[model samples]
Target: MADIESATAQKLLKAFMQFRKTGWHDKKISGHNPSEFKVLATIQQGANEKDYEMKLSEISQRLQVTPPTVTQIINNLEKDGLVERTVDPEDRRAVKIKLTPTGMEATAKARIRFTETFTGLIDYLGEEESEQFADLLTKVQHYFSELNR
Candidate 1:
């Protein structure tokens, strides 16, 4: 049983590595990488929920990245005219982030593409299998998260 479990684990690891190597996530959306798009999506969702510009710390916490890393991405996005940064009026030391018009449009288009890609995956997997796959993935994530704790 131990040998069989070890072999199964090896196969699972290999499958994960191959899936990553396939570059399914490396594809750019609206000239932005997946990480950048994630930031855009987070900010957009935050705006919709709070109706206010998000502080840098909030974004970092939501994305589970360091504040400096979020700042670096924000800098790049700012340079590309997709986002705007402003100093908080109540707290000059704090910076707020908001999407510009261009950013909103880009995010909208990218969102459509994201949906279509997932829709294709669902179609390929069939409805029942796709649901099962999602449940399995959730369980895997939960298992790993508990391991960390």
Candidate 2:
């Protein structure tokens, strides 16, 4: 094999480019758009039935987007009956966002669809090979986390 630096990036970039579309297509069972579903999923992950809520600042940090972008998405979600915003009791200026029943259902369906797709995909690999691939991917994730830190 050529030196690692000599390798072309085209293949890797193309694969990543196709990732979103492929995952979206796989989650077609959800009916909601993939991006909308993602927002709901993110919020649901942070908030639970007991006391689930987060402010725009927290969302912006988690999604790595501007507050405006998060607001736009939330606005659409609120219209679609997927999310709602409440004035924080402790801090009148802060708003807390939470998922609606519809949003939770959509997220659950998308998760199931995604899992099914992933399972279908893993069927192509042998046990040892799949484990090795998972380990490598985990290492890459840790590498990025370290870089961010």
Candidate 3:
């Protein structure tokens, strides 16, 4: 049983590594890498849920990256005219990040591509299997979260 479990874990890890190398989730989205797109998407979602602004710390938290890393990415995005940074009015020390018009357009395109990919997955996996996969993924995510705690 232990040997079988170890083999299964090794296979799973290899498959995931191959998947990452193939950039399966990053290929359809143009003009940005997967990480950059994730940051853009996070900011867009935050804006839609709350105000049209998100703090740098909020972005760091959402991305599960360090503040310095988020700042570096934000600086690059700003240089590309995809995002703008402003000082938070309520907290002058804090900075707010927002998408520029170009950023919004890019994000919209990325979202459309993402939805199309998901639709394809549903078609391939069927509705029931897809739902099960989603549930399993959520459970795995929660398990990791608990482990971190």
What TM-score does each of the candidates earn?
A: 0.89, 0.68, 0.78
Tens digit per residue, CA lDDT, model 1, 36-145: 99999999999999865899999999999999999999999999999999999999999999999999999999999999999999999999999999999999999999
The TM-score of predicted model 2 comes to: 0.68
Name the lDDT value of residue 19 in candidate 2. 77
Least accurate 10 contiguous residues by lDDT in model 1: 1-10
* Predictions in order: lDDT: 0.93, 0.78, 0.91
> How many collisions between residues are there in candidate 1?
0
Model 2 scores what on Cα lDDT?
0.78
As for candidate 2, its clashing pairs are: none
**Order of all candidates by TM-score, from best down to worst?**
1, 3, 2
Q: Candidate 3: which pairs clash?
A: none
122 Cα displacement, candidate 3 (Å): 1.0
Candidate 2 lDDT, 69-143, residue by residue in tens: 889889998998888899988899888898888878877887888777678768878677878989988997898
TM-score head-to-head 1 vs 2, winner: 1
Highest-scoring model, lDDT: 1
Residue 84 in model 3: shift from native, Å?
A: 0.6
